[model samples]
Target: MQDTYLHHNHQEKHLKSSELLTDIVIGMSDGLTVPFALAAGLSGAVSNTSLIVVAGIAEIAAGSIAMGLGGYLAGKTEQDHYNSELKIEYDEIETKTEVEKEEVRIFFREWGFSKELQDKAVEEICKDKDRWVEFMMKHELGLDKPDPKRASKSAFNIGLSYVMGGLIPLSPYFFVANSEDALKVSVGVTLICLFVFGYFKSKMTGVNPVIGGLKVMMIGAAAAAAAFAIAKVIDGK
Candidate 1:
């Protein structure tokens, strides 16, 4: 029993860590791509590194806030949906006990429980209303109770990740005097970062890391290239 409890706790912790990783990926991917493309575009149209730096900084600030708020809202929505389903589950168990019990029996039946075992299991589980409600919430609704602080944590994590990623492409502009030079360095740095980020992300999610890395690097490269081309054409006109 103690071993089982410890294993369950480990699984729960892993799930939470996975959620955090997902938020970082969402923020960082956009942070790297958008700023890199913006810098590349401006480099094609302008000669001043200072202008690109200022615009990049402003974009990073705005992007972080927007992404953070999106994470917060998504977390809140998940929590709200879980709570609403939980309430309904409790109500059903209270007002429709027999139906609820039958549902539990069906689950046991699906698990290949004997009729005698199903009866015993249902009785044991339903003895505690809270436990019964929790079981139903997990099996019937497939929702684990979300952490109360998930929204704020997600916001902080995503926002911080965004800032960190956005700075990578923008950092060259701080030291390079010319926008074109800055853009060249920025492209190299950002593409490498994107490949490395994608490699680890894919490994964590059980994918082919090399292919994933190349895919991510190509996406950032393509975005920057498109922006640069468009800016060049527009500036030439």
Candidate 2:
């Protein structure tokens, strides 16, 4: 029993890490792609490396804010939804005691509990209204209570990841004097980073790392290429 409890704790920690990884992936994928594309586009249109660098910085700042706010709002929505459901569960347990008890019995029935054991479980569980409602929420509604701090944590993680990812592509622009030359270096660096990032991200989630890596690399390349093409056409006009 002690070993089982420890294993369950480990599983919970792993689940939280998985959630964090997902948020990082969300932020980093867009972070690498958008700034890289913007820089490529700007490099195509302008001869000034300074202008491209400045614009890339501005876009990263704005994009991080937008993405962080989106993550915060999503987390807040989940919390609110859980709270609303919890309240409803409590009310039902209070006002419809017999119906709630029957629901508990039905749950035990579905679990394949023996008739005598089901009666014993229901009798034991229903003695405490709080415990009864808690069980119903978990077993019936399939909702876990979300961490109250999840919204702020998600916002911080996503925003920080975006800043880190965005800096990679933009860093090359700072080093080179010419925008076109900087773009060439940035493309080489960013595509490699994208492949590596995607490979590990997929590997963590049990995907084929090679395929995922290539897919992500191609996507970054395509986005940059399209943006560069559009800017070149506009510049030619």
Top-TM-score candidate index: 1
Please provide, for model 1 over 1-237, each residue's C-alpha lDDT reduced to its tens digit, 9 standing for 90 to 100: 999999778843242346888889999999999999999999999999999999999999999999999999999999999999989999999899999999999999999999999999999999999999999999988889999899999998999899999999999999999989888899899999999998988777767999999999999999999999999999993
lDDT of candidate 2 over 100-178, digit per residue (tens): 9999999999999999999999999999888888899899999888989999888988988898899999999898999
Quote model 2's TM-score. 0.91
Count of steric clashes across candidates, in order: 0, 0
Q: Residue 215 of candidate 2: its Cα lDDT?
A: 92
Model 1 lDDT on a 0 to 1 scale: 0.93
* Models, CA RMSD each: 4.3, 3.8
- Provide the lowest-lDDT 10-residue window in model 1: 10-19
